[model samples]
Target: MTTQIKMTEPQMLQQLLKQGFEHLNQGQIREAADCCQRAIHIKPDLVPAHFLVGLVALEGQDRKTAFQAFNSVTTLQKNHPAAWAQIAKLCMSDGQINLADNALKQALKYPNKDPMVHDLLGTVLSKMGEHKNARKCFQEAVTLQPNHPPYMLNYANNLIYQGELEESESVLEDIIRIQPNSPQAHWSFSGAQKATNTKHIETMQSLVSEKNIHPRSLPFYFYAMGKEYEDLQEWDKAFESFSKGAKARRETVEFDEAHEVATFKHIEDTFTKEWFEQDQKGHSSDAPIFVLGQPRTGTTLVERIITSHSQVHSAGELQQFGLAIRRLSNHQDPRRFSPQLFTEALKLDPQKIGGLYLQTTEKLSGGKPRFVDKLPQNYLMIPLILKALPNAKIVHLTRNPMDACFASYKQLFADAYLHSYDQAEMARHHARYRHLMDVWRERFPGQFFDISYEATTSDLEPNARALIDFLELPWEDTCLHFHEQKTAVSTASSIQVREPAHTRSIGRWKHYEQQLSTMMSTLHEQGVPIDN
Candidate 1:
């Protein structure tokens, strides 16, 4: 008779883990969790089992359980690379950036061979505004997996943000070669450089002409084609590509107009002038300088001007203030900014909220006396910001409504500006934003400094002087030389901001007046003025 053997507990545990991982990959969360839990029960300190559990929890959006499971994995096996990477991701999302940085440092102590771990680690660092460090991690990932287009793309995108355009273009070229049909690679490659000829345009056109192109990728190809046409001065072809791209992209995301309406109404209804005047104490710090307004309205340009000062450092697009308010309010709504969340945020103590925000944001400040938090969407949080940091300086960048709307509509963002893909929705949102800002100006006269993009770009010196004066800082010649600064810009305006101030982008919407009738008519109906 042939010898028969029953599998040992350790071997059985390995089999369970394999099944768990397969189920996780298949999106069978409960099945994966059951397998992991069984493995854990058999060997309570099984690190891989716990790590798998953490991954499943993350997929299910149970961050608490995910953190616990990851912590368990780290406890069982210190210097576990993937566990630390996931932990750092959670910490970063919670606005505990210093903790995330610490976690990353721990992860880097060991040799991590996994490309995904490096990519995850790099993304957290990117969100923390440590773009240089993030670039290193992305490079490591790219080196580990040269054939993977996503890995190479991550490296290239960071290169662009860091203003390494030549390298970005080379890397993108490689990505295109590796995957000849990648829509994203084409889009990114088009953005990284201005078109000199129609050669690459014809290449992208061939790929997009394939009837089998996926719906999810249609936007990228179309946007790339649109940009090339725009550069070539073929306005009609550009608009056609832009509209088709926008329509395809719009189908993939969700945006509720009613939610935005209520959220704007809630802010105006609650944060009255009298409420701000109330002696409800807030964190007393004068280190924050907020550069905010609608996206594509010169917010980044102004932030660059402000941070060109020796005393100011740029903290790119912080989520801390909103996270602080949300955490302290004890409301666990999933949406970033919502009517429910905003209403609940009113219950928070300004002092506590402000204290948490500064504490989390402290690590991003580069020993500067003041720091610029250049988040355009922060215009929505102006009332809270003033209440929380009374001495904070707010600069609102204004642009012609049509120009601003058109600019956003043309560009493809990475996960934000949801309404930009639809002309009517984009116009209505802009109108609402303008109305709320007017209310804020009336409620808190002289609380903020407003500068128009047109005026600032046309008369750089006087506007720059006034801006410097608003912050009570002595004027410096450096503010006028922002384009020459060595700081890496991580926004849509990255490439353009590298050049001296110019009014070339002004009245750009006029080029598309025929194509943008829906947007202009919507703005008119909403009573939003087209002029700055």
Candidate 2:
């Protein structure tokens, strides 16, 4: 006598869903999507299957498909917190702040929302410049899930942005204690320590060597070492460490004569006035105040002075301009610019571009009226910027080319910038940059202003006055006292920005005369004035 086994279709669907979820947890999105699709085929009403499918689509960067999938989940399960959170993240990426905010608000309406929902909301708020609100959300997230390192790290990041170094240190310490092997936590912790205590420099160096930290971490570690050496006025060691970091990540050398000729050819072939005009038409006529030049060229100092005025706000080097250009290109290769591409770019809605920029920046600087985008590399993008925002003012900060190149070559930038380390490459790139600027100046005379770093540092008052007038802002005494400004300095020149203006940095490249001999000759041949 054998008993017949009976299984319902619903039971099979449930089993598949379980298996799908397990695969999802193991990071097998494709496999999980297949299982979930099978489950949905068996039980078409299964909302979780739709949700899982949506997540898998997102992993594949198919936003439209993901949106449809998530929309299906919401149709089936109206109050799904996870779905709402996903919508918020999508909106944030698209630069849709109000929509992101509304979605997160809806997510919170559901009971027992995941701590991650709060964390995402916090990131959105931080980008919007609502630091206080962002801090509250991050704090709540950490409290709800204390063991989560990411949440703690984000909370610490907020603290660092607010210029609250001690508080950030405390948060980082807790994170390190919870997960001792976290390289990021240690690196960030080291950064905070470097800011507050010059004495901790030796300790950081020791840790870097002993831990055999990741290569990516080398730049920051060396940067910290350079800062310490600079603080001690140990110029040789500072130069060596800075050079090491720069050399490790150099993409190309700027000063090389051969590289210079190649770069000149590329610029002539690639960038043109018409190309800029098209880019300009894509953005609003309202030009942003661009502060650009070589790194350590007093651009940051100028920004600090200008931002100290009542009307101006300091926005750190904007990653957005590069992002905006990429978006406007619409996947068209920048190396292959054509009239059709220009026409397509020109037709982009200015209001949309401006609104997106304002939305993204509004969250970063706490809703300041006049913000600064102090990215040094914006020098290369000047044409695009001028075209996009015709009403925008351009401040071209100039330092002695030799000094600027030397400073660039010796610094360990966080991101890989090609020409910084190689002397010949650095010289060539610098020449190309100058040539482009000359063309831009000839094209748009009054719109661009050149402020020498020497003038700005040697005589702070006149330069400050000139800068204020250029920005069309009322002169404030505090602009002269930018060192006293209590804002968070995020760049490598952070410590330098905290002090009064000085000429000590000017012409400091002469000390490495032997090493920079080739660069010097290249600068002279390019007709760049070199005193040394």
Candidate 3:
């Protein structure tokens, strides 16, 4: 009777867990959390509840809370494969590849571990630059779950990375056949098509015209249309399509003042002279390459060109340096900047920060000789990077100020870059970026390379060769064929990257001159040269 009663309790716990999962699936996060917490309280050994809570916390962007929750799960089930895999994902997100690798190794010890474990391990291996091993893991995951969308997408992406365009296209086509209405599948197909330089405009046009298409499909449609027009050298049509796409992105003004205040405080707090001194103390190999300039000033294009070099890889946009500065200045109240706080920020672990950056790049580049970290906003942090890694090379991409400002104002960024919405704010930000770059040039002359977008477009091959020489890379013909390079570019300029290099982007602001007089006046007041 006692044995039977104990078995009944196990079934009851399983039923409760199912109920919690149902709540989770219904978008009731708080309710799901409550149910999971209750289940865990009832059965301290319930690993799933703990995992659910951790996942919920992570979804809420509460990393500390999520970590604590996952830590509890691991403590209770030391050898649990799922718990280890969860921890590995968290570590990967935190840029702790080594820890994630170890966690994944532990997870593979379990018999018949989830396919996601293999997928995640593959991602971590990819991040660590272990491409061969990552490919094996992805292959294993696909074999284990042949129809999984994520596994298919990731494996296809890997093939794209390896320049296997036909194979990637086939895989994406399979995805489209299986899930014809999937916006992401179409987007990936477009990317593969762009890479192969095959005409895909008609396919995209058909998708756009489908009744009841996904809202998320709009951006890609307009982006694809823009690319199509650009390929045909229809500059006005391309600009219009891009404008429509940017506007279609939904905008909300909640917490506008708070956001502005926080950003202003962050800028004031992090860019102090004292903060600069603190970041200078420790550095090692000077292999840092910065791709910086105004957003839409062709920084991404520059990155794509440089990264095409055999020795160079892309690190995407790194927020860590800025995050490090902000962390160091955390002792200061946001209400105002203090000299004392500035002095304390000066005492931060520059060596530690530099070490963290090196650690991150080492993983991302997979032992490539050089890598490009092209975060346009990094223009503001160039002084700190130079101080920390004096051997680092900075490439500053310059566009006509009006063109840059107009481009920025007309595009929509994800929530993080809120300043671009208003033309005046966009102009001000561009001026500030220019001023800062000038200051950096004065302070560290030979450390920087200034490339004009006009020069690059007017004479693509020569400028590209010069850039290669500047980076000390053996010239590759492929660098000159950058537009034909098919990699996943997650930026507003994705459409532009698909086409060959051209000078049509120049003087684009003139068409909207009447719409941009305020921005022009602001630029004039700031002494920015706009006539060109």
Best by lDDT: 1
lDDT of 3 by residue, 1-532 (tens): 3554444767777877788778777777788788887788789878888888887787777777888888888898877776687777777765566677778788778765477778877776665556567778888888999977878888877676655668878988887777665555666566555433325556666777889876766765675566556556566776676666655543332224444444444545556456454525667665678898888889888888987777778777655565455455555344222344434545666666676677655666636788888778777566567666666788989889998887776554555455565566667767766776666666656777899998998888889998888887799988977777655554556556766888887997887677678789988888888974
The per-model lDDT (C-alpha) reads 0.90, 0.71, 0.70
Off by over 4 Å in 3: 1-7, 108-113, 125-143, 146-151, 155-163, 173-181, 191-241, 250-284, 304-316, 323-345, 368-370, 402-416, 420-425, 460-527
Ranking by lDDT: 1, 2, 3
Query: In model 2, what is the error at residue 521, expressed in angstroms?
Result: 7.2
User: Least lDDT summed over 10 consecutive residues: which range in candidate 2?
Assistant: 334-343
TM-score attained by model 3: 0.76
lDDT of candidate 2 vs native? 0.71
Misplaced by over 4 Å in model 2 are 1-87, 94-113, 195-287, 294-296, 315-369, 375-377, 402-427, 484-499, 502-532
Error of 3 at 12 (Å): 2.0
RMSD of each: 2.2, 5.7, 5.6
lDDT of 2 by residue, 354-447 (tens): 5456555565554555778887877766655665566677888888888898877776655435567677677767777777778777766777
Write out the backbone clash pairs for model 1.
none
Candidate 2's clash total is 25
Q: Highest TM-score among the candidates is held by which one?
A: 1
